[model samples]
Target: MKMSREQKYRLIEEAGEEELALLKQQVKQSPWRQKYHIQPSTGLLNDPNGFAYYQGEYHLFYQWFPLGTDHGMKYWYHLKSADLSDWQDCGIGIAPGDPQDSHGAYSGSGLEHEGQLYLMYTGNTRDNNWIRHPYQCMAVMNADGQITKWDQPVIREVPSGYTDHFRDPKVWRAGEQFYCVIGAQRENGTGSIVVYRSPDLAQWEWAGELSTSLTAFGYMWECPDYFEIDGQGVLLFCPQGLQPESDKYRNIYQSGYVIGDRMNMNTLELQHGEFHELDYGFDFYAPQTTEGADGQRIIIGWMGLPDIEYPTDQQGWAHCLTLPRELHLRNGKLLQKPVPALADRRGSKASFSGRFTGRQQVPDFAGEAYELICTYTAEDEQDHVPNEQSAVTAGQASVFGVELRTGENEKTVIGYDAQTQKLTLDRSAAGKPFAESYGTTRSCVLDQPLRQLHIFVDVSSVEIFVNEGEAVFTSRIFPSRGSQGIVFFAENGAVHLQAEKWDYL
Candidate 1:
């Protein structure tokens, strides 16, 4: 049930004590719950919020609705990780109750200044007529991880010519000034990103919207994050109402970034190049990034998509954060690699290699939680043989990468089509029917010959980094627990293959 203003705040405190207790019990019986990913102990979780390194630990907050599986009475549930691989839940960071955030504490970013940690979030409130009033609110966290909301919002009111869809303020310090970029919508129903500047983090000034090269990008943009990678200013945001292209933007919504050399603070405009999708997969959105203690930019995103029905809802919980990834700018393209710290979770290892023509199941290479690296040398397209079971057209693929999470009746396939130069991840037979809105097949075009596929498989999610992060796919799959088989196959031609597997400890 949707929560009103009063009921949300009242339930926030009362539900905290009771809901968490029952959550611990509900999770034990949910087979789809992740063992290593960050997830809500109960209810629904979405949009990673206020991710920053503070004091001696890394703090990550998420949009949580603890009462049930649906969105209701949003709160910020805080969790701290010393190494980004092991996390400790720290309970509710901010709850909606006060006038500023009476309806919900929406998405935002985090900052650690001096000795205190601060969070700037969009406070969602609704009038009796059901009109939304968004407030860019601020809060602080002590060394112990306890949070205190500021007395009032630092930035109030939606600027003229924009709807109340303005929210998800991402704050970062640049030079001597602090700036925030929030997603907004114009009255004409176009999406934009607006910047706000503050010298002391209290008073904020309108910094205008970033200029777009396209005439119409999307209707509304949500969860905007502005930051610099290397020397390029990266503006990452999720845009709604974009039509799908031949091989891109096939999801209901898309999250991506445009890279530019400089951001003009006066006009709040970014002179950027072409837009690129951050992750090409069935489920990924609302990604946030923070600089690590070692000066590396680390990012984490919700592993599930919006407006889709997940199989986990019946188990009483849904959604999780993708494994933390390190961002890099390589050859003008953004590259995402799973952080090396995750190696600490590795328990055992297995290796195999061979020449395969059709398909071969790798012995002892089956598990719901492990990291797999598959390398294949594709034969010449004209020399390759065709398999009747393959969906790819003739002369398109000489070698197939591999498939994981395979069962007697189901499998999730990740393969390379040489003719089309497309890399595909197909989950049509992964078990359990889902909403028709959720697409089962996702593909990414490759410029060079297929070489390597780095994959991470959790209980219910799969993240594939192709060609050392040249392209990446992050998706959530609901295969049965017994569907843990892995196989490598090539159609019409023989290809050399080497596979390595590491199970999480």
Candidate 2:
């Protein structure tokens, strides 16, 4: 029997304990299942949405396609958290069927207005000929958790002189006015950002456009986000179809930012600096951020890139979210550190420190899901102390770092070159290859000495924060269960080190 649209919406919107238990049973049998990450309950998950802290809880929603591992019609799956560490599934928050969002409820953000939660997202529609019409739609979630979609789109149609590529409205309140920035593409085929302002949340007016003839950005931009930090405005967005620029923009798409002292909303002009990639990793895109109740800019990103295949596709599910990170601005760059609340999961901790002359492997340093922190300096440094020793002489490379998943010729390597100031994550041998289009290695350069490395490893993912979050790399890895051994190796010179490991619950 064909299910009516109302029946389908009822089925999805009311999915609760019975649905979750079944999903848990099915997913528990998959070897690639993550223990602590926010993955899809059944099918595919992408692009976290509606990330807002409200009513003493943090609400997060994601683009979900529950019937399969592919991007079919997308729905929004909602979850709430009290501490941002442990989460409760709130079932489906929005279902597609209404005329406004018949095709899908695409990406957007959340805001708290007058004690109610307001969500603004893109409503994606396609004709039989596959022509696209996107709408900037709105909905309200009352204190009782009932979501009511507004009958019509706040911004009814695509504006003049742009393609239907306009979408992903990130809304925020600046003083008494509500402002939004949406990603768009010019008629001439360059990516840009369009600003909109509303005195009240109901009526919106076009502010202006922010684009560049100064540089060749991609043809279209997606998921544009704007915020203020330390009195500076930061614009972050994802650009598609960008040609590789040396060591940057190497992914299928890129997520980056341009810092500006201020943004002229009416003119859409920004006194900004150069663009910089947010993460240098094999898999990271479509990041969304929110300011927490404590005044920290927190961000979470989809742990998988678009148009890529993963081994987990065979297991009936795919993709997850990176751990939530707190963003800070330091020396004109964004610094991202995993929220300290995550430390509550640490159990059975161990500490190690030493002066290592060469290739040295710490005994009992092995786990698939754990957090590792290390501090070290080049051997030539005369001002350092060494404790508890492990020594060997590996010859001339002038680089230092660690190797993970070291078994059966499958290991993911993260290394830093003091001379070049380049940090790289090489996953050539991590495991099953996903796509040739996404190369096996990604790198970033540090503006200062490489003093510390903080790494978090789940069953199939790795997130590295370098030099107190001066730079970060988040990627997924597929390694055999037996490939859990970790080793630290250095070349040419000795290393003064202090390290700690904590197994995660």
Candidate 3:
């Protein structure tokens, strides 16, 4: 709904000279406004804030700056979904209209108490000396959905030795007392999580810090979530300052967790020394967790990185959330799969069993929008002949390729980069104007060996979840009219393919 005249005037009255300038700057900065791409109606958006499951629905609130592309005062943007795939955007939930949150209502989490939805977030503010201060606060919506916030900040401040960087509180109920973790920076200039205990959800008592390892992993950690997955505990967070570490940290920051043994609640101990990647993809970060109604530990994340320049920003919007993932411990490694409910939206099966030798130029079945899974491996051990490079030939990438094509106007070529020994995706062959607009080339190097590309392509968007959740590449392509037929090429290779089509109606 558009804002009423009265509402607009009220907004104007609420602003000062600086706020007015900032608002004008945000509106002026957009080169484009990306539609249906989950963007702020106005300013900048970052992490998904205040996420939880309630009333048979998954409610996800994100950082929203609806007036512009700048990271101005944030409001909690609301969306809820019953099946995790079809989402209902509920507009702004908690806004920065409150005086206590005049600066910005930063990142946090959501919970339900006494049949009421309660939100806890960092109340960001600047004091007289321009020092950053954070506060934990609460808000609730009545049964009718009319929202109201408490007058005072629930948890006023953290103890000394931790600077104003303390924020992004992730709260959960353990046994009876409510426990929460806040990202903090020590006086020594390192990052940590401070655990706190709150009995009534209002007042909080500071517990101790989690770790002071300072092992050079990353600077301040953001969005810390602790939960038990498959009888074991997992601590998930996005650590800042993490640089490229071999096959990891390829993106700006990382979204991952450490599986550990949970100690006493008051002590806040995690008895594990290892960290793992949450999703090895071009975009994924700031993951949060919630226990599903089915007793499964489910997770969701904000998919765009901070500080990295986004092409979409030119379109007057930025960022999106990753599909919800079900996390599990498999074979001593973390495993993730798209939530099952997404399959319900798969419409119909556009697939059939066929021996794909890549020689078959026909796609068997094709659609402007489709979901296809193609699997491949060496036809035999003898066929695993590596390229003549002394390195990859010395290691791997000696596998086969199962290529995909659409028409002279559109096609996607994919194969392993033999020299790098990494799986690669190619859209170089997606021809014509679409090819020219997209420059017809894209790819992502897989962390592990992937023998398949489980592709989900909507009319304009392509999301390739590689090898059953190992890695993903998401890209957008606009094609000329009447260029929708897809093809498969063996390209001196052989494999099995399943092409699934859906109406998405």
State which candidate has the highest TM-score: 1
lDDT of 3 at 340: 82
Which segments of model 3 are wrong by more than 4 Å?
1-43, 212-215, 356-369, 377-421, 425-452, 458-462, 470-492
The Cα error of candidate 1 at residue 499, in Å, is 0.9
With candidate 3 superimposed using the best TM-score fit, by how many Å does residue 472's alpha carbon deviate from the native?
4.7
lDDT of 1: 0.84
Listed per model in order, the count of residue pairs whose N, CA or C atoms clash below 3 Å is 5, 0, 16
- Evaluated against the true structure, the overall lDDT of model 2 is 0.84
1-505: candidate 3 lDDT, tens digit per residue: 2234333323324657776576556645543333224455554577887777788888888887654445656778888878777788788788765656767778888888888778888887776776777888888865555567889998887688887788888889888899888887777766678898889888888888885333456677778888776667778777877777656666666677787677457566677747777755455677777777787877777756766555445444556665677777765556677688767656566555444544454434665555677654433336544222222232223444444436664665556654454765555554322223322344546555555567765544456666676665654444433556665554343444444555443
The C-alpha stretches of model 2 lying farther than 4 A from their native spots are: 1-26, 211-215, 378-397
> What are the lDDT figures for the candidates, one per model?
0.84, 0.84, 0.65
For residues 161-231, could you state the per-residue lDDT of candidate 1 as single tens digits?
89999999999988889999899999999998888899988889987777767547899999998888887
The TM-score, computed over Cα atoms with residue i paired to residue i, of candidate 2 is: 0.92
Q: Which residue segments of model 1 deviate by more than 4 Å?
A: 1-10, 14-26, 378-397
On lDDT, the stronger of 1 and 3 is 1
Worst 10 residues of 1 by lDDT: 385-394
